[model samples]
Target chain A: MTDRILAVVTLNMDIVAGGAPIFFARNQEEQVKMARYLARTLDAMVHDLENGVYIIVKH
Target chain B: MEHYLGTIIAGTLAGTVARMVMLRLDYRQYPGYPHGYLSHLSLGFIASALGAVAIPAILKPDYTAVTFLALAASQFREIRGIERKTLEHLDENELVKRGSDYIEGIARTFEARNYLAMACALLTGIAYELGRAPAAIIMALLSIIFVRTFMAGETIGDICEVVPAKLWFKDSILMVENIGFINIGLKEIREKITAEGLAVLITPKNADARATIHDLGQRQAMAHTVTVLLGTKKDVDLPEFTPLARIDPDSGAVGLYAVPVERDIDALILAVKRTPVLESARSRPLKTQAGRMAAR
Candidate 1:
């Protein structure tokens, strides 16, 4: 299986854009919660872009 | 044929015993079940029979019977293919995979063991024909000892040193001592890893070993072996807990990170050290002049 960006969870909406589904959270807590949920649902890993964005990747 | 009965029996017994001595149910755990053992032992018996018949056939001036040894060689090649297929099928479901290199190494070893068994039988037959039962017994023991010692390959510990390393978090990035491992975005998961995860640095003894461990397949084999022995906390969905082996490009050292069910550091180190060095991953650069100059 190839790695794909399943979703993007971010505090800042301006940082990420493109084909992957994006979710914007109000703060770090909500972003972590959303990323964890998306990761569980998608069976993917949450990688921090470290730019107020977390990308959920299926590897 | 009656005159050769004792020679044939002695040779076949020695060959089968040699195969049994080589077949071990080790931590690698392949061919561990009864069914696997039965199939291999049966093949060993057939190979021994083939080897035993060769000397008598030549003595009887029946040259055609000796051609069966060529057939035996082809059959052993099939054993290697069968082993590779079985392992590849099993790897699909493993949480941590024994990479292709490791699988190939295992397959090759299985094929070689059969040859060793055949050789043991042939030698015992020759000895029995020349000097009777006593010489045959001594030859069997010598050949079995040779197979056990010389046929066995080196392990990770033979070429590298495994030492425990501290796991820390540099923000979202997990660090194994000075080497940066992975980027874990989840705070709770990162905290769990920092608190419980085990890390180790595999330092190569020389340039040849450095190049060998630099192979991606070798690193993956190390990760798979460590996870299997230590019982990983990883599940299908829990990619965060999956073990990883990362290399330090500057020093050519590999760092392994794992969250095991049994949190024993000593066991983890032992498990890594015991992993067989994959033949496909072996690199001997020091043999070359340019490599020797670079090492200097």
Candidate 2:
């Protein structure tokens, strides 16, 4: 867990921030799950844009 | 003896009538059961009894008895607290939650109603003590009518125009007429909304009306009233499908989207029109000289 933005999970199944596309999710539900997992494990926060993006930031 | 009986009958009748007129079980379903009604009625009775006895007590040189009126005022204030607590508790389960402002307004209304009942009782008692049976009966009827008129608040239609709007998605973003509502990237949710949803555009007649409708609590109240009349397709999980009132930045007109259980568009329109203006959301800027000058 680092004190920086870990990854950004776009609802369209793309990891825009962290390199190597850390989590590949099928749909919105999986996207949310993966985002939460990244947030919890990485000690981060999930910012749901309510459009199609969830930006995860390490706390 | 005759005057005493007349005062008792007149005061009780006036207070009871006022309470009955105010105790309504509409969409809110407040005072929903018989027990609730009984409690209010009993309170009304006690209020009237106190009011009716005031004149006689004063005549008998008992000044301390008037303190009971102050005691009743405190008791009625407690009713406001009870109403707030009850509504707040019930709000947790509401699909479209009534905001705290609305809840506070309702609680205040209940408290005010009890005071109105007390005032009516006191007035009727005075009239009866002065003019006897016939005057007492006449005053009671007049008091009921006056109470009814006073309590009749303004409705949404009085302030704005509610018209049907075409609900369509432009580039997968929901719009009512030209006003933007919600951005939905999901095709299924968009399709479901288009297939079943009803849309209405509420354009405020004037600047004051615009200010009133701009209040989020008022918009929510409009949604709740529409849901109560036409029902909503909303469930717990689906936030996108929930009834929403979005304002157009350019026009200040509100766009409403709701997928009703009953697809009666006319009834939905009527319900929106009939939705009572929430007290918390009322803003009469145009009535002020500064606002009028600014507008000019």
Best-fitting candidate, measured by TM-score?
1
Best by lDDT: 1
Task: Write the residue-wise lDDT of candidate 2 on B206-249 in tens digits.
Answer: 88888889899888888888887788877654555668898988
| Tens-digit per-residue lDDT, B78-105, candidate 1 | 9999999999999999999898888998
DockQ of candidate model 1: 0.82
Give candidate 1 regions above 4 Å deviation. B25-31
TM-score of chain B of each: 0.97, 0.94
Q: Write the per-residue lDDT of candidate 1 for residues A23-49, one digit (tens) a residue.
A: 999999889899999999888899998
TM-score of chain A of 2: 0.66
Q: Model 2 scores what on Cα lDDT?
A: 0.78
The alpha-carbon deviation from the true structure for residue B256 of candidate 2, after best TM-score superposition, in angstroms, is 1.4
> Which CAPRI tier for candidate 2?
incorrect
Native-to-model Cα distance after best TM-score fit, residue B162 in candidate 2, in Å: 0.8
Q: What is the Cα-based TM-score of model 2?
A: 0.84
Scored by DockQ, the top model is 1
